[model samples]
Target: MRIISFQLPVVLSDLDGNRKRFLKAMAEHADDKDVIFMLPEMWGCGFDYKNLQNFAEHTYELISEIQSIINSDTLVITTHPETNQNKVFNTVYAVTKTAVIGKYRKNFLFSPTGEDNYFDKGDDICVVDFKGVRVGFLLCYEIRFPEMFRLTASAGADVVAIPAVWPEAKKDHWQTLTKARAVENQMYVIGCNCSVMHTKKKDMDCGYSVAYDPWGSNLYESVSGEHVLTCEINRENVNDIRQKIPSLSDAMKVFEIKRR
Candidate 1:
């Protein structure tokens, strides 16, 4: 699968501006088939907690517009604020030109930023089969949790997409954890993050949108600013690595034995 990750600068609460920029950037690749395009977490609005509900109202509209632009086989993954009743969740959606295939609401809210106070967590694991490849999801803060990645791997994921707004201060963690997940699971991992956020107080994100192959090798890595990084990954490579290492299966067997 061809993975294209966009490291965009989020305009904080400016939903219209962010929407226009994202759509314009995606328009060029609208016809690109057999590809997965990844955008940063909360691309439409950067954790604009005060007005998140207002932003959530426009989430479907943005998805509709995105669906209208991309090809039928092009899969786009991104996260945004979603509202259901009185609760709001940080939802990641997997979409194609035809329909929304799957969604994973972020379960582990970042308590450092009081994310748990604002958003309700999701319990389901999102693993979707697109074309011939199995795709999985892991939102920003979720990268710190290895069990989530293991669950996706167990569910037969060939590649995992991580949409993040990771801080510049934790750049090393962002890079290390992404690679760890890929190597540990023997699956492709693509992480897309923001360059900077334009809010009342400008916040700089790590912005090192990167991809790692099953062998823990870097497929693509972006610079500190806004940029688009693309790389082609093969599911056969994942299979080869897992077959050679066999750690994933070994660990699963060990867990099964311990359960008895």
Candidate 2:
């Protein structure tokens, strides 16, 4: 499967402008088929917590607009603040041209960002089959949790997609955790991050959107800017690595023992 990670500089509180930018990005890859496009968390609103409620109100419309732009074979994955039954969630959706294939609400809210105060946590892990490969969805801060990654990989996910709004200060942590998740799980990891720098505050994003193969090798990585990093992912490499290492198979026995 081919994967494209889009590192976009989203404007805070500028929903219309961001949507236009997203559409423009999609246009570049409109004709491409059998590809997965991964965008950063809150790509439409740039982590503007103050206006999250307003954004959540238009989530359905925004999703529909995005869905209209892509072809049937391309799968777009991104996160937005969603309102469901009067409750809000930081949710990621896997969308095809026809319908939404999967949705995963972020379970581990970033306490430092006060996300826990505004959004409800999700209880379920989401894994979807795209074509023949299984893909898992995870939001920004959840990358810090290995248990979630293990659970998704154990569930037969060949690739894990992470949409993030990570700050520049924690770039090292982001890089380390991304590769660690891929290495430990023996699956491909696709991390898409925002590049918009906050001028009024000290907070800025380091846009090193990256992809790691099953052997923890860097397949594609971008510099600190807006970029579309595209690369082909071979599922055969995943099977080969797991067969050679067999780490996940061993870990399953340990998991069963702990359950008892």
Candidate 3:
């Protein structure tokens, strides 16, 4: 399957602008099938917490528009502000042309940025099957939590997509964690991060979109810039790596930890 990550600039609170850029990118790859396209976290509005409700109001419209542009076999993954019961959540959506195949809200909020205050956390861990591939999700801050990823791996996830707005300051952490997730989980890890934002914040959105195979090999890595990174992966690799290492299967399903 072909996995593509859309790394582009996000203008804070500019729903229309971000939507246009997202659609333009989607249009370019509209005809492709058996492909998964991942977008940066909150691609619609970049943490415009003050106007989050307004952004949430347009979430459905933006999704519908994207649905119209993609092919039936194409699956698009991204996070946006979604309102439920008057509470806004950072929701991850896996959408096909016909319907929304999978959905998961951000479980781990970034408290450093006060994300916990603005967004309601989700309780479920989502792992959905798309064209025979078990695709899992991890929003920005959630990547730091290995337990969540281990759960996804144990649940039979072949690929995990991380949508983030990671900063340039911690680029090394981004690189290390992304590879580690793929290595430990024995699955493909695709990270799609936003590039140069139109914000006053110095260099927050450092777009280094990347993909790694189950063997922790870099399939494709983009420099610090706005560019769509694509890599073709074979599902067989996951099986092969698991058979070779047998780490996932050898792991103890249940264990007791006592203070030493």
**Strongest candidate by TM-score:** 1
Candidate 2: clashing residue pairs, number: 0
Local accuracy of candidate 1 as per-residue lDDT tens digits, 72-110 = 879999788999888999999999888889999888999
Question: Between prediction 1 and prediction 3, which has the larger lDDT?
Answer: 1
Which digits, one per residue and each the tens of the lDDT, describe model 2 over residues 1-260? 79988888877778898889888898889899899999888888866777788998888787788788889899999788988888889999999988888999988999987889888888878899999989998887888999889888877899999998888778888888999999999999999987864434655766988799999998885578878889999888999999999999898877752210
Best model per lDDT: 1
Q: Model 1: runs farther than 4 Å from truth? A: 256-260
lDDT, candidates in the order shown: 0.87, 0.86, 0.86
Could you estimate the TM-score for every candidate?
A: 0.96, 0.95, 0.95
Ten-residue region with minimum lDDT total, candidate 3:
251-260
Model 2 residue 252 CA deviation in Å = 0.4
Per-residue alpha-carbon lDDT of candidate 3 for residues 1-260, written as tens digits (9 for 90 to 100): 89988889988887889989989998999999899999999989889888899988888888899999998889999788999898999999999888888898888999998999999988878889998999999887787988888877877799999999988778888988889999988999889998866665654658777798999998885588878888998889999999999877777445431211
Determine the C-alpha RMSD for candidate 1 after optimal superposition of all C-alphas: 2.0
Error at 104, model 2, angstroms: 0.1
